[model samples]
Target chain A: MSIFINKQTRVLVQGITGKQGSFHTAQMLEYGTNIIAGVSPGKGGQNVEGVPVYDTVFAAIEEETVDASILFIPAPFARDAAFEALDAGVKLIVLIPEHIPLQDAMDIMAYAQKQNAVIVGPNTFGLVSSGSSKIGIMPNRYFVPGPVGIVSRSGTLCYEIVGHLTGNDIGTTTVVGLGGDRVVGLNFIDVLRRFEEDPETKTVILVGEIGGSSEEEAATFISSSMKKPVIAYLAGRSAPPGKRMGHAGAIIERGRGTFESKVKALNAAGVEVAGLPNEVPAMIKKILS
Target chain B: MKLYEYLGKKLFHRYDIPVPHSKIVESPEEAAEAAAELGDVVIKSQVLSGKRGKAGGIAFASNPGEARKEAERILNMRLNDLTVEKLLVEEKLQIEQELYLALTVDGALRCPVVLASLDGGMDVEEVAEGRMIKWPIDVSIGLQDYMTREICRRMGVSGALQKEFIKLLPKLYKMFRELDAELAEINPLALTPDGLVAADAKVTIDDDALYRHPQLPRVKEKTDLELKAEELDIAYVELDGNIAVMANGAGITMATLDMVQHYGGAAANFLDFGGGASVERTAQALELLLGTNPKVLLINIFGGITRCDIVAEGFVKVRESKGIDLPVSFRLVGTKEAEGRAILEKVGIKTFNSMDEAVRHAVDLTEAS
Candidate 1:
């Protein structure tokens, strides 16, 4: 069984009328995600991919149960959309937009915690329960239903690794994109905990990059608690110090989140860290065998 | 977007946080004039980087002539690769005690954290962790009065000084929240004979939130290529290497850079065209990559939302228009891979579906060159 989402999970699309929202809504629908309703303040009474749209999340939830909400709202309006979804009692939020204000992200996370909900990203590609459901903007072609549970911070990098895995006849139980924001909803440990509990997930593949203590923290969690074998592929080892390598969170700051530090931590935790993406599938094969 | 000391102080003053009397001057004459009016001034190089004090970017001036001389020396100085164009000429304060206070977002906690230290003026990072008291502020509740008081008490601060800190901490928190600041810092919250005065300010507003605060100056601490990339809406970082690397996502782009290095080649720069890049945008990104004039260009696209065909079309467009001179290694996969590969093939360019093969080829080309 997959974690977080499956075929029966009811999803709500926020800002459904927007370009990204409409496009991904069709993609998610095509992937057989149970999209119950859409929310676009003024564009109520419309249907996107045969799903009904409402003025507010409250109005949408009044008709059907929405287990999760995927937002495609712009950076500035993300806070209000997320708050509305939380207030409407939606437990899971998948924020797709990048460059969301740091303050808004913090406030959203704090609010989500208070409401007993989970947020996926402010700059994330969302998540997928392979073969069962898709709630993110990942190109559906690469993922397949299998034993490995994938958790990553980068969308394309995850897709790249998944492509290699799928090419080698391996599949995934679930792929969780934790986002590349400095302040995001869920982290490595949070997703790893779920991966550990999932019966279908025999092995966990962590796709980490340079930045933050998340990888190191994940390593600590894996060593102490995780029963499943974990393999990792960390990016940006060649990154220069003090330079933000594209992602807001992907930077070496105060010598804290260096590549060496993360690699050492993961190695100490007994996780085989792949030097390259293509090397991961073999590592996973060796462990599973 | 790290604001200069002068700008940070301006924001501090606006927020009613007590700061030393200061004037920003671009020239030595202006520095001398401001010092003559202010009396016993400190000429500080207005730069964005830290450790400027150690770089001789800071100097004390007891009189106008000394201020002018110091300003001249500083204005000509380059601290941390940044040229000192402006100087903050301010009245020097007699420090009774030095304390550190800052409000920054704690990534792990996903909340704003207030860090207070009795030891100040020196690097807070270098200070013992025991000396610094960190309190994570609940974003929903914000910075409470009791939290600040508790922090002061934990740091052994009491009496009139505690009261001043109690009043000042909230203002700093407020500034941090309202300005959408990533970090609002006072390195040396000095206690002078008069009262508590903020001797230094290092405020960095979130670049994402810059749109909301239009009044704040957009500091250009980037290279010309970086600035150009910003204008082109491409995420780019200049590096000191020979191979120019281009990729679709930030994570993958970094991985591509790592791969290049792993294969014994250094990347000239990091450029991410971002997701769902159109044919034109891809062509533009190619042009920007070419502008770096690297020995080789490595284009790695794990096409998901970003279509391989579109990226291929961009390559063809650039090849047809400007004519690419340097060797290019293209790795195309994911959606419409065949179509993208065919497009590149029609233009007499072969593509590698495997990232390893493509990266190795790029590195080999760089070595051969």
Candidate 2:
């Protein structure tokens, strides 16, 4: 019923031996994610959090039933790990690493797309299907099963949206953190399209920041194919030009990625735009009503 | 992560790229000496971030005395919040044509993207306004020899200069790769009255990639404000806004900062205390933030592995010890959330379960302030 992830998805963890990989793996497992197996070179034959570890993604695929793979590998090795999972027929993957060298990130994403795979983030904070599959590092307690689908560039802000939705008795069907990295594997438009098609996702909440034309692109897409009501909010409106906000990708450089331009673009596209984060829930409520 | 122009040019020169004769000056005497080294020199303020020229960081002096004055002025000034601790004085370039060339990772395509423009000597921003010769190169293929050649040819580089262009591209590309640079730019990659000389160079190394290349560049703690924040060892990213945020850990702190922006408020800084922030540390962190003269403060802490009691203890100490000199709002969740709230409430501040409420209150308070 939902897009990308739901109760049925069984995920695997790549690079499960590293500190971040193992820590998040344990957290996801504890959050009730079906982390079927873990993969790390030379860490095979060991068990973490009751999940079997394998040497490579291919090995992990063979040993366990996996619907998706979340990459926690270092940037240098992320390219090969992603390709390995894709080659082994991992249909869906999410990359949680940031600052991936641009070249490697592109080749793998292109390669994965050619293989008909869906990649979430290169510098992303994974996606979650409330109470079903927990990926990345989003707080589990903050999410509840609901009809709204949420996508954001900022992971921390997503909690605010989720908390808003939760406060209003609106729970997300799936919340996706696209990350604020400049060169990410997926953008808001990509995830929005998926949510648009999903039967369970009745409405969508998009959280964008003042950087890049990704929001503009998403707005254009929303004006056309987006059948569901989409309420969007963009952060950093007053951010000075060329001042990089907390996120790497959320910088206003040479007037390309400005909050004003994006707001105009989104407003022009017939999408109800919340001027600020606090107004998001009210806007969404207005759209639904 | 951003390299000063002089340092970037030094790396450029090491790769055999021709540049104006240059030396960095730490003192006004050295500045005069550097200007003396070149009959006519360009005194450029050494700041880490971009748009130095727009910030009046670059000044040209025809005489050593003028250059010394320019250097002296710059060294004491702050450009775009970056202090000019040094000046890069270089031989004045008789630039005939200023071309633009940069090798950067394209986010959309997830590959190395090369942008080239023929219009030279003007701000690259102006050329960016015009159409650019954009080529997206797959990393597996790397920078192809033919494309680099084609790019040079398109930019009207020819003869010995074309060959030099050919040589320059690959070497620069190699250096870019070797350094794990996120961005490498040769603005005014020029055909001078002399030859192909890089008028200016800028390179930003990926922080994540720094572990592999230890000597590349340490994350230099810049800015007196940032340095002061560093005294408390808080992860702080200063913003142009009037609202300050102090939270534990990079991730949550970033979230709180973003939330501020989301709710139509700007965060003055991104300060992360990491996991398990003690009361002493929290007070010091608060003290550092107080220096920012924030209209209001929003402190969001999620204590899981780091206990809420510890965070509560920190909050109480910051208030009891520092006497709450600033207008602030706080949110404490997970692991003794109740206790965290109780401690804050006793100090006349309230905690919220919803970030929406905390952010709204903080934004309104700051706006009112």
Top candidate when judged by TM-score against the true structure: 1
Scored by CA lDDT, what does every candidate get? 0.92, 0.77
B73 Cα displacement, candidate 2 (Å)? 7.0
Give the per-residue lDDT digits (tens) of candidate 1, residues A1-289.
9999999999999999889999999999988899999999999999998989999999998899999999999899999999999998999999999999999999999999999999999789999999989999999877799899999999999998999999999999999999999999999999999999988899999999998999999999999999899999999899998899888999998887999999999999989899899998898898778
Model 2 lDDT per residue over B20-53, tens place: 8988888888989888778899888876666788
List the DockQ of the predictions in order.
Answer: 0.90, 0.35
TM-score of chain A of 2: 0.94
Q: Tell me the TM-score of each prediction against the true structure.
A: 0.99, 0.85
TM-score of 2: 0.85
Candidate 1 chain A has its poorest 10 consecutive residues by lDDT at A280-289
Top-lDDT candidate index: 1
Residues B1-369, model 1: lDDT tens digits: 999999999999999999999899999999999999999998899888889889899999999999999999998877888888999999999999998999998999999999999999998879898999999999888888899789989999889988898789999999999999999999999999988899999999999989998888888899898998898879999999999989999999999989998889999999999999999999999898888889998999888888989999988889889999889898998889999999888878989979899999999998898
Which residue pairs in candidate 2 have backbone atoms (N, alpha carbon, C) closer than 3 angstroms, thus clashing? A106-B110, A146-A171, A183-B107, A277-B262, A277-B263, B98-B120, B249-B274, B279-B314
Which sections of candidate 1 miss by over 4 Å?
none
Location of the lowest summed lDDT over 10 successive residues in candidate 1 chain B:
B75-84
